[model samples]
Target chain A: MEIKILGTGCPNCKTLENRVRRVVTQNNIDARIIKVEDIMDIMSYNIMATPGLVVNEKVMTKGRVPSEREIHELLTL
Target chain B: MFLNPTKNREKAGIRKYSALWTGILVAIILIVVFVRFDLFERLENGVNWFVFGLLNLPADSHLASALEFFLYDSIKILFLVFVIVFLMGIVNSYFPVDRVKNYLSRNKLYGFEYLMASLFGTVTPFCSCSSVPLFIGFVSGGIPLGVTFSFLITSPLVNEVAIGLFVGLFGLKTTLIYVISGVLLGTVSGIILQTLKLEKYLSPWVKDILSKAQHEQEVFQLEKQSFKERLPVIWQEAAKIIKGILPYVLIGIAIGGLMHGYIPQGFFEKYIGKDNPFAVPIAVILAVPMYSNASGILPVIQVLVSKGIPLGTAIAFMMGVVGLSFPEAMLLKKIMSWKLIAIFFGTVSLCIIISGYLFNFIL
Candidate 1:
């Protein structure tokens, strides 16, 4: 599994990354996580808002963080 | 495919929705009851008396009275912020204003187009920091220099938080002027800069990008998201805003409270008062370096207006901090050339100054 978090290091972005990390660790899932901070790099994903989440090359969410259960469910899949 | 997670807590989710509805119904009933029984007034009066008692100083103590006033004002303003921010969160959830690449990439736009773009910028929610990325996105996507400039200014300066706080703190008339003037400042500056043919001022990296057709295919997907898909996200965003801004609100209101209690009317009148026509211009200069978020600054603005400072002069100071902060300008340097940065600030500063003077004279 692969997850990419996109933002320019705002507070919300930081929180989202931390949450994703915690969820991944707790689940003990074999997943690769990447943080994308560059403006152009993130835009290439077609997200208009920060703190976007891309899972397996698919954009999952943008502008807001998903819930813990939501993350857990996504990982389980 | 990623979004449809089976409801693991279907029971819990149902209960939550029911609870939400019940809470709303209860709130409505409570409001009606409070209005009929004058419970709200009684509650407020009691709170005031309780604050006085808590201070435990003589009524004549200037500092004690000021503390009381600060407590009262802060509570009121905080409550207002909480309600407005929550509603705005829902609105934002429903009407997500995606920065349209197609519209922004236009080679040339009429004056009305610039006005519309600036106004759109005002209504969409964004902070100064987040706005930098949007600005970069617009510029990189071949958004006209002037139109992009307008979005850059309006995005940070005139958002829901600023406008809501203004209306709650300064009343409708002043807020109307501030909103209109803020958007107009963006529009006029955009037109002026475009006329000067300042596209050369943009960073070479941004200006050189002419990938019109290839980049067009990378459009934001999720336009067809169901309400269920977005509900949790909306709540999360609204909660983030309230939590993030609450601290600043308290701190701002505390300062405002102190200003109200301790500062004499004559003190303000003497310094940045109406007699000093330079007050507005001075405020514009002072506010840039002291830049903070609108949430942090609006309470202080409330203090200035309450302190007998002219509306226009105080507004100039507010615009200064909100519109063009030193930090934001520095950040813009990433994509904007030195000349472009200078032009952006120069035009905005001039417009802010003019607005300050206009408000002072008219009102």
Candidate 2:
């Protein structure tokens, strides 16, 4: 599994990224998590809001941080 | 959206899309509703009694107080929004984006830098929408993410109306506290962002924009103009902004007016007042989707204050309404992804709640 966190480095964006990392670690998910900070790449996904989460190739959430349980569900699915 | 020349000419010739038509439509609707509901008749009767003070009224009655009860409250709010939106237009028109970018783009993101950026943002009269564009400009100019965050946090939290109202209603000490808290929130949030090293999460497009950026040095080089010339430009910009925001201002005023004249005092007190420990958080949550500027909502605040709502909670609600409205979040969705928008809302809402609690304790 692959998870990506996206934003332009605003505080909220950073917080979301950190939360994603924590959730990934705590759940012991066998996934490669990556952070994508570039604006163009994020825009290419047609997401206008930042601090987004992409699971695998699909965009999971935008402009928010999801709880560990939510991340776990996304990971499992 | 190809426009045929004949259709364009016919459309121009019709003159149907006029402000007068809009104004007339609004007036008709208001009049029809008031008449149908007997609201106007009641208002007339109420005014006469209130004005003459029917029961052994004092000879020297305060007309201003009476006027304030009915009209001034709404008028003041509309006026404040007008001034803010007008000033925002001026800042947008006159203040070159590159100037702000240059000032904030130092490579270092020290505490002092964060403080300065936050203070600068607080002083400048930029609305959230305008602030986003400037934030983008700053990021594009290679300003450190933490420093940029400082500016973004303080911009909406420490607006001019909020400061003035704090000073006027709550006195200097409370106003100072609000200002200090705003700065502290910005600084702490920025530091936290820096610590997380979240720059790596920014989308590649932003990186590309920043990497290719030769700073537009010429943009800020203003030629010295005579005061007369400058005045006209300022007036023109103010007029343009006023025209754009006038309808929204009026709508806010209308809602405020209704709340002032009709809403029962007990309602707000029962639900959202200081007696309820949960009021602060509940108000914050409710305020997230509602949109109103500081001025438009002042009348509601006035009623809430009179009805025993906690000052901190009321202000928090106001801040959430203005700063985190759903429209704002949605508008941002055009520029940011849904994930980013959610995070932004979460962070700002948390900050607003913290400030609310801080004010409640200190005040």
In model 1, residue pairs whose N, Cα or C atoms come closer than 3 Å (at least 3 residues apart or on different chains), thus clashing, are: none
**Model 2 chain B worst lDDT window (10 residues):** B14-23
Candidate 2 global TM-score: 0.58
DockQ, all candidates in order = 0.36, 0.03
Model 1 spans > 4 angstroms off:
B1-43, B52-58, B99-110, B140-142, B211-232
Backbone clashes counted, model 1: 0
Report the C-alpha lDDT of model 2 over B1-363, residue by residue, as the tens digit: 887999875664444334234434554675487559876346545655654555434544444234434444334344444444444434433333334556666334355878877776675654443444455567666676777777777777776556644543444586677678787878777666656565445555555655665433443443344333444554554555455445644554455445545555566666665657787888899888776455456545655665667778977887787666776665455455677667667777888888887777766
What TM-score does candidate 1 get on C-alpha atoms? Answer: 0.83
Model 1, span B206-268: residue lDDT tens: 565533422333543324444456556655766677677778887887888778887877567
- Steric collisions counted per model: 0, 36
For each candidate, give its TM-score against the true structure: 0.83, 0.58
* Candidate 1, residue B93: how far the Cα is off, in Å: 2.6
Model 1, span A1-77: residue lDDT tens? 99999987877788889889999999898899999988668767866668788899888877667778887887777
